[model samples]
Target: MSTETVIPKVEKKHLENPTGGSKMEKVPGKPFMEIHDEINDEGQGNFPLILDDSVETQTQEDVKPKRMRKLTSGGQEMYEKEVEKYTAELIHYRKNLYILINSYYSGELETLEVRLMPDRINKELSKYQQISEKFIGFLKRYRTAESAREEATQKIIFKSIVSKAKTILNEIEIKLKQAQLAKSFATGRKFKPPSASSMLIKQRAKMDAAKTNLRFASKEAEPERLQFKLEEEELKTKAELLKKKVEAKLQMELLKSEKEVAIAETEFNAVREELEMEGSRSSGKSMASVVDPRQHIERYLQKQQEIMKSVYINPQQMQPPELNVHAAPFEPKSEDIRQTNYEINNVSVANELSKFLLKKESIDVSFYEI
Candidate 1:
């Protein structure tokens, strides 16, 4: 083995492998420090390099002045007119808001819209007030300063105020639009007509109901007929009731008559029994004995009168006429004799006859005429 000097030839290759290459060699042209400084300058290391162009474009756009339309005299006059109109409108709105707020505070104007109106109105009024102050300041400046530059500046300020007023008015318009949308959502359905199908259904239902009612009316016949039928039924019921009452009354009268007849029969039977008893008692007595004792006395008085007349006529014959005391021709039975004796004992008829004969004999014949 000869001891020769061996040197290893190392071939330098371009960095294609990331792990093997230096970190600075990974970037194509820029150094790592320069990239780091650029990232630091951008204030964000995490920002993507793709946004650099957009950022630069945005910056350039920001640096350029925005184009504004310059108003001519006519446009200026129109703008002023518009401003004045808007100011008047804003004043009108403010006054309305103030009235509404006062009403709300005084417990009037109570509604959902009125309640929410104050906040929106106040916001707009505040904006308008700011603009108005600015306008007044501008006017004051324009009045006091006589320089052209000052006048131009004042004009610019007035324009700004008008623009501000317009922006505030636009905000108010947006709020009004929102309110209108809300109102539409709330009250829109009330104004909408019913759907055709619903209306048709209701009409059909009504027609059906009407038909049902008509059918019922036809079934029941005319109202007059129904009324007559009801009246007839009522009359029949009343007549039946009256008939029952009449029958009851007749029956009651019949019962009363029967009771009266029974009472009369009972009284007649009592009277007949009394009369029969009296007849039986009287049937045992003779008719002469049954004659009143007053008749016997009258006969005795007649005989005395006859004797006195006979004595008065024949005074030469002083003898009195004989009295026919036994004028009854029937032979006196023992019962009749006993009855006559009882009558004579009870009434003293014999004594009365004797006394009358004695009185006749005692009377002076010279003082009596036949």
Candidate 2:
């Protein structure tokens, strides 16, 4: 009966396990190990070891931290009630924070510092909105104006270019017509002859020389051309002078003829007056003795001796004036003189003599003869 003392090893097994349990068997003096296994309800092998305990040793792996398990039945009810209280308080705090943030955003939280801060912010926002709209409108107008200006400028440039092109085309057409005219002239076509003014100066000189030489052989060897031309001018002048002299002589002859005609007319008028006076003075004489004798005076004088016995009988003579010693010379009556002048015939005496001879032939000479 030697007296021997046995040392017992104690180790933590499961942290979630109770400190002491009546269901667990206790070893009095021997070291015991408690292990916890993660297993299915059947406690199969090869499962994960969650807790392990060893005699005389404690390991960090044995005491591992885990999520808290559900509380005890009595404590679970009280824990749920406490959790509800805490959640209510936390929700209230979160709601309060959100309200603060929202109020800040809405410009309502600054009311203590500036009384009308929210109103001022709202007013400033409205003003900014108006300014933005006005700016946008201005920008739109500016863009429209710029576009219009650009389009107008483009149109103007295009029109100018088109006008220039048209002018060029017109010029080209004119040039083409000129080219065609030149081509036609080059061809054998009998085109309109060139104008005298269009002839070249050298060509006109050659033509004038040839014509001058051909017309005048003297000009072919003329020593002094100007002197020869002067001589011709002198000849023309002389001929013109001669023509003028002849015309002057003819005009002088015409004047002489006209003077002679005037003189003859005057003499004729004088003779007519004398005839009328003589005829009127012999009005008391027999018509056969005076009128007929005066009408055929030239022919009657030529045959007076032969015709006087048959045609020229002595007219009855009026009684002579009384040779009274007491009577004065008688004045001629004015009416008698006037009537004598009015009765005279003013025709040609030669023509009257021929007419008187013709009249005798027409009359019956047998009836007058006794």
Work out the TM-score per prediction.
Answer: 0.24, 0.22
Candidate 1 matches the true fold with a TM-score of: 0.24
Deviation from native of the Cα of residue 49 in model 2, angstroms: 99
For model 1, residues 1-370, the per-residue Cα lDDT tens digits are 2122211121232222222222122233211111122223213222111111011111222222233345568856765664465456545444443344334334454356554664665675566566555555543433322222233433433343344334434544575678789988889767877899999999999999999999998878888798999999999999999999999987776676666556555654454444344335644433334344346557756866887887775568668779799787767688787655554443343454345444434442312321
Model 2: pairs clashing at backbone N, Cα or C within 3 Å: none
What's the number of clashes in each of the models? Answer: 0, 0
Q: Who wins the TM-score comparison?
A: 1
Cα RMSD for candidates in order:
31.5, 42.6
